[model samples]
Target chain A: MGVEGVEPHYQIVVTRDGSLDNIEVQVEVSEQIFSDEVKSLEKLGKRLQTEIKDLLGISCRIKLVEPKTIQRSEGKAKRVIDNRKI
Target chain B: MKVKQIAIFLENKSGRLADISHTLAANAINIRALSLADTADFGILRLVVSETEKAQQVLKSAGFTVGITEVLAVEVPDKPGALDLVLQVVSKAGLNVEYMYAFTRKSGETGMLLFRFDDQERAIKAFQDAGCKLLSDEEVHAL
Candidate 1:
């Protein structure tokens, strides 16, 4: 998921709850746009969470990050890292 | 003067912080000052430590997202309005403080405040020109 200037790459991580839990989306944003602006990123992240929940009908938590901080691949970008416990 | 601060990306899970501290401690890296900023999922643990490069390597090898940021360290008298005055000067100079944190040394005579500004040079000039007592890198690390 991405906005105009803020591009987000995400990973799916398991929730803390044991029995039943909503999906969690860990988003890595492009640093060129957000830099370290936490407030702005928080706002954008909330909007993204709302939009995702509405579109997919599956509620999930959003975690924002910087792009280079996340691992990259050679050919196709490895967007989502599945950390969800099976 | 600028001080090197290490920012570690920590997942919001039990024992994450403990694991980091233990890793550093086991490697003989002393943490001088630290601040943890977090959301529900993850936390950013910023630290002023004894050795920058070694600490970075240790943390990275331990599988943590580590980054180094140059921050200004200002020593202010441990009293009321000391920090407010510094902020006022920064605001008056039209500088933005990205983030800031405070720590006290063992001496207790003065307090150290770590400030991150978008423009490092501008902030340094503003604070210096305003005659705010700033700490050198050596001074900060020694503390």
Candidate 2:
């Protein structure tokens, strides 16, 4: 979901009233980064789901959306904007 | 003269940065400066901080692969050729720069830098002797 020279960030959105929400994942990478990582992101999502539920002890049904591109930040990208239950 | 930054080995994926950042945030550890060296499937999360030892412990306790390294934080301008100048200085000292990334934070006039060299101790000595203004651990952490 990220291109080369870019960092990837994801938005975790949860609606109390059951509305389709847009959780933005900004991945800043090079142009060549997107061709790969699509499948792996899906797998990574599954792994995160398990880890979050187990370690953090949170049980919230989440959905995986397509990865989006983000403008490159110099260093240390601010990822994981959790709008869910905020 | 020289400072250590934690280099965390991570398989590139979603939530990887989140996992570390969230943990650090939860522990009241602030990231002073950081970068990630990413290959195809793996990346090294490098960070300078006020508390290097504690940050490494927190990260390891969370099951992260962590390494402590001495990196050179050179303060250069944010303009073009600033990197070139640093390279030239390092090269003049007969040092091979393994990698470098722009700093995450900056003062009003000076920008910070993170550099990995083939030989950090020698490079630091040379850079400092050459008046390269090697940032102290406190300087890098203040970033």
Candidate 3:
């Protein structure tokens, strides 16, 4: 997490379409999290995808979302949402 | 002098920019100048508005990711090579211009260039030493 000014809130939504399964990680970000020298959203997504693949041994997709875009649960924060069909 | 600018993170979807403008208009936020940088998936909208705090609050309340940054506003003469002269000064000082945009006043003979530099303090010092006309926050808002 060397990237500066990145909000810690995120939501991982897992979805499957017929035979295709995908794990999408949506991260809340700000302007400081990116710059002209550093990479763009696509590069950040690729990096996150690699990290997730290494940690969980599965491929996933990364989505950079606006701050506070993810819902905050009142009772307990739900970090992961599974929308995959069995 | 340094001017406060607002940077908003917007998803590259249809009507997203319109939504932001509509929200600001409803709140009476006057955008003095603006620049939009985009990629395949997202866009960063940099705006110099008359009311910085109000614009930030309204945009945030409207569910837009907004950030405030201090940028340098330089008044360039309305003539050819005016910007080039300024750039030469910046280049000689070894300053990097991260991004910049220009806007002209309706009744003025000088145009303003909004710049986001990598090293803001150093850029300010360089401009001052080079005798560049830097606009203050009040002057920018007044324009």
Candidate 4:
């Protein structure tokens, strides 16, 4: 298994009645997940949506937000979400 | 007039549905109305249950990706176009239904419908305006 750790996805769907209207599915990752050129989560959202549609045959709107703040201490770095307020 | 439904993404594999059932059973949650949305590689388990909070916790703790959704428990006579009627409303509203499945009831006079739209909140409002009965969280829990 290519178990390179796991990233958690919190999918929020804004549906009217039982029909899907606009979907906002997001995944939150630590700061390190945002590499050098990837400045925003929009890229991730597009990637996931395409993947989902290809897999499910249902198109959905998605939003991914990865706010990674961390300081390397001991053996691991703790990513924080505090940077979004500014 | 609305029911709280939980949709859990299930990997398509042997015993997947049974696993969900066992997990819910372990927590003493009883299912009321349920339907399944499926693709080739995966499936979504839409369940209306007696205990939402407990069921939510059970599913999350089990590491199954889940979502809380609003679904229409519309009833129709066991006849053709009964389903088409709902579809018509959805189409009229310019809403694209991602998926839907039909269910038969124990009474044998009615067929229960479960569906998902692009926008759930609007879909609910539209159906209610059109006089479709929506099951609430309490109503689903009681059953």
Best-fitting candidate, scored by lDDT: 3
Docking class of 2: incorrect
Report the Cα interface RMSD of each model, rounded to 1 decimal.
4.4, 11.9, 3.2, 12.0
Could you give me the TM-score of model 4 versus the true structure?
0.57
Which sequence of candidate numbers ranks them by DockQ, best first?
3, 1, 4, 2
lDDT of 2 by residue, B1-143 (tens): 77788877566578988999999999999887777766555566778877999998998788665668787788876676777777787888898766666763554467777777778888988877777777888777765
Q: Which of 3 and 4 is ahead in DockQ?
A: 3
Give the per-residue lDDT digits (tens) of candidate 3, residues B1-143. Answer: 89999888887789999999999899988899989988766788989998999998998888887888888999998888988999998999999888899987753488899888889999999999999999999999987
Fraction of true inter-chain Cα contacts (below 8 Å) kept per model? 0.05, 0.00, 0.28, 0.00
Which is the better candidate, 2 or 3, if ranked by lDDT? 3
User: Between 2 and 4, whose lDDT is larger?
Assistant: 2
Q: For model 3, state the Cα shift of residue B130 in Å.
A: 1.7
- Candidate 4 lDDT over A1-86, as tens digits, reads 11122254343445443443555454544333332112223354456677778887777665433222112357643322222222
Model 4 docking grade? incorrect
lDDT for each residue of candidate 3 in A1-86, tens digit (9 for 90 to 100) = 44446677789899988898878888887656754322455667777778778888988777888777789889989999999768
CA error at residue A46 for candidate 4, angstroms = 6.7
Candidate with the larger DockQ of 1 and 3: 3
Instruction: For model 4 chain B, give the 10-residue run with minimal summed lDDT.
Output: B35-44
What TM-score against the true fold does each predicted structure earn? Answer: 0.71, 0.58, 0.79, 0.57
Q: On residues A1-86, what C-alpha lDDT tens digit does candidate 1 reach at each position?
A: 44565544556766546667657676665433342335655787788889888888878887765444556668887765555476
How does model 2 score on DockQ? Answer: 0.02
Note the Cα lDDT for every prediction shown. 0.78, 0.64, 0.83, 0.62
In candidate 1, position A13 carries an lDDT of 67
Residue B115: error of model 1 in Å? 0.2
